[model samples]
Target: MDVKTKMRPQILLFGDSITEQSFRSGGWGAALADTYSRKADVIVRGYGGYNTRWALFLLHHIFAMDNRSAPVATTIFFGANDAALPGRNSERQNVPVEEYRDNLKKIVQHLQAISPTMIIALITPPPIDEKGRMEFARSLYGENTMKLPERTNEAAGVYAKQCIELAKDMGINSIDLWSKMQETDGWQKTFLSDGLHLTPEGNAVVHKEVVRVFSEAGLSAEDMPYDFPHHSIIDGKNPEKAFRVQCS
Candidate 1:
């Protein structure tokens, strides 16, 4: 590790809905904050329906608020809403890959310019409804359910991989939570209780994996019991279905 990278990070977390939850909203951000509270100042800057472009806008918004000597660690987890299917209120989808990569790059350049020693960590967006959270939700909801375009698992996997590769090429520190969550037991089993979100238990699964990354990055945590709150937006428990939680 570079001596410069060892400095404490301000930990400005930016992303879409999952990362933007109540302090106790039972999502990964809260859990992560709990783990690293003693080690870093974890600031949450997440927006529910924001996409890559929206996040890029947010980076600039944050830059207006933060400057040199502001913070060190920066982690970004955007793209879930960006990849959302076009709908009544969702015009945020398939933002061009080149543009998406550029959006990230621009954020990185600005961070580097302001904080030359900042530990800017770019995270691949988490997994989506690879196991049919929507179909399961329909089954659970009956006619009361609204049908959404089936988001193919292939899309999420490919996009996440691309982002990881791009982050690596850009020389940003990265925590690949997508791969980490896939390896944890009974994790993917409940990864998505909804098509594009996670239940509390699902977030707990993710919380553990991300804290592991933080620990590896030299942040420490106090051990806590795992508490999972299951959401039924998308539902399934078959271990067989759970096994499909492979990460490419």
Candidate 2:
């Protein structure tokens, strides 16, 4: 590997569709990339529509035990799809609440085995607006074919609580997106584009929360140096000198 690549640390974002879309315009992952631009590489490994069970099956591949280049931090976000109601079309993604908690614990254990010192962040699933989600489902499957949303806020809340409690039990940082987004009135309209997905504003909220947690962990932007000197500070006649010194 090149000096630059070898020197730069990474932050891994692993989860389902919410994570897949995290690099979209005005998304939280994108914001993190920008925020840590030179300091770290934000690597996203999001599997759309995947739940904890499927994720467990693929975890070994995504985070190889032999890979010594472990990330400085990793965020495990799931449960949106897993919160699907029983007997619904989305039941395929549904995992029992206890299993969901166990899966999260296992994921953390796996990651720790890879990097004992790596910081781990657990993000609980956000709230779901059943009416809006059902409307979206109806639009896709036809009104007569779809009677209700596959996921509900109540069910999601249970999963989110389990996630938070597990994180606490493990002594890892946890982001309670479920409760934070709903702190204001009419969060469904303001934060969510669909009943489950985040709006641009919602993305901002997540970005802010991530920064807050990182800061609390003493990984503030100010504490981390940029990958290389800024253009304004680099010697115009010999930019390579700056790169060599910084990346060495």
Candidate 2 TM-score, C-alpha based:
0.95
Residue runs of model 1 more than 4 Å from their true location after superposition: 1-9, 65-69, 85-91, 130-132, 136-150, 184-189, 220-248
- Residue pairs with backbone atoms closer than 3 Å in model 1 (clashes): 9-73, 10-72, 193-234, 201-228, 201-229
Overall local distance difference test of candidate 2 = 0.90
Clashing pairs in 2: none
The TM-score values for the models, in the order shown, are: 0.71, 0.95
* lDDT: worst 10-residue window of model 2: 1-10
What are the RMSDs of all candidates, in order? 14.6, 1.6
Residue-wise lDDT of candidate 2 within 173-208, one digit each (tens)? 999999999997999979988799999998898899
Number of the predicted model whose lDDT against the real structure is largest: 2
